[model samples]
Target: MEKIILASSSPRRKEILNRFNLNPLIVEAKIEEKKSYNESPEQVAMALAFEKALWVCNKFNNEEVVIGADTIVVLGNRILGKPKDEEDAFRILSLLNNKEHSVITGISIIRANTNIKIIDYESTLVRFRHLSEEQIKRYINTKEPMDKAGAYGIQGYGEVLVEKIDGCYSNVVGLPLGRLDYLLNKFFNIKIL
Candidate 1:
């Protein structure tokens, strides 16, 4: 099996890969995450993911596979990232109180010492139930919303706010395992476990 490197520091992504019994070498990518003014959410995500993968691949000379991913929450045209502070989290949650948002995760895989690069994105629609001020405040007090996109994490306390989801559950969390597995098998000829 080719050595696998994960170019991200997200615990959620690491956990997901671990679930498949694969322990990848963790190498974080150092890239400026600035969204282009005219770029769509999907484009930004893919670009970031690609940048991360490319960065890590350049740093290693061994024949290995590098994976990178970026995720964002979008409500219409606006994109929401990790909140900067408690106030920001509260404001973001207020806006998403009773609305549906889309979570897009872009994944990139590259082969070290080669030009082989594969990039794709998965989108999941998440609908939040109407939340009262107290409910939002209580959740925010837990500090779980600060590190998550759109000020919420579907796999944690924020699950209570989700009314329905219209796509892959894992995509909303961070990575899409099914799509990732397929890509790995097709491109790298490697199977999970």
Candidate 2:
């Protein structure tokens, strides 16, 4: 197996890869995640993922395979990012209550030694159950929503907030395993299984 480097600090992302037995080196990419108004949600996600992967790959001899990813929550044209504060978390959760939104994750893989790089994105439709103010407040107190893109983590206590999910569950957690496996196999001749 090739040496894999994960260019993210997210534990959920690392955990997902670990489940596939791809024990990757954790190399957190120290790039500012900027949201672009001109680009579509997909473009923004892919661009951030590419930026992170390229940042880490530049430090290596290019022989290592680096993976970077970004997840975003979108309600119509609005992109709901991580909450700035507890109040912000409340507002975000309130907006998403009883509404269906989209979770899009962008993934980028780079193997500069082989001159191989690929960027792709996955979208999952998530419907939030009708949440009472007390429920949102209680969930906010857990602080899980502060660092997550959607003010809720489907893998944690936030799972109760979800009424239905129409797509990849892993994508909502921060990475898209199926898409990542496909990209690895098709582009870099790598197979997790």
Using lDDT as the measure, the top candidate is: 2
Off by over 4 Å in 1: none
Candidate 2 lDDT, 1-193, residue by residue in tens: 7889999999999998898889999999999989999999999999999999999999889489999999999999999999999999999999999999999999999995667889999999999999999999999999889999979999999999999999899899999888999999998899988
Candidate 2: where are CA atoms >4 Å away? Answer: none
Report the error of model 2 at residue 127, Å.
0.4
Encode model 1's per-residue lDDT on 96-176: one tens digit a residue: 989999999999999998878999999999999999999999999999998888999999999999999999999999998
Clashing pairs in 2: none
Alpha carbon lDDT at 11, candidate 2: 94
User: TM-score for each prediction?
Assistant: 0.97, 0.98
lDDT at 91, model 1: 94
Give residue 136's lDDT in candidate 2 (0 to 100): 97
Q: How far does residue 28 in candidate 1 sit from its true spot (Å)?
A: 1.2
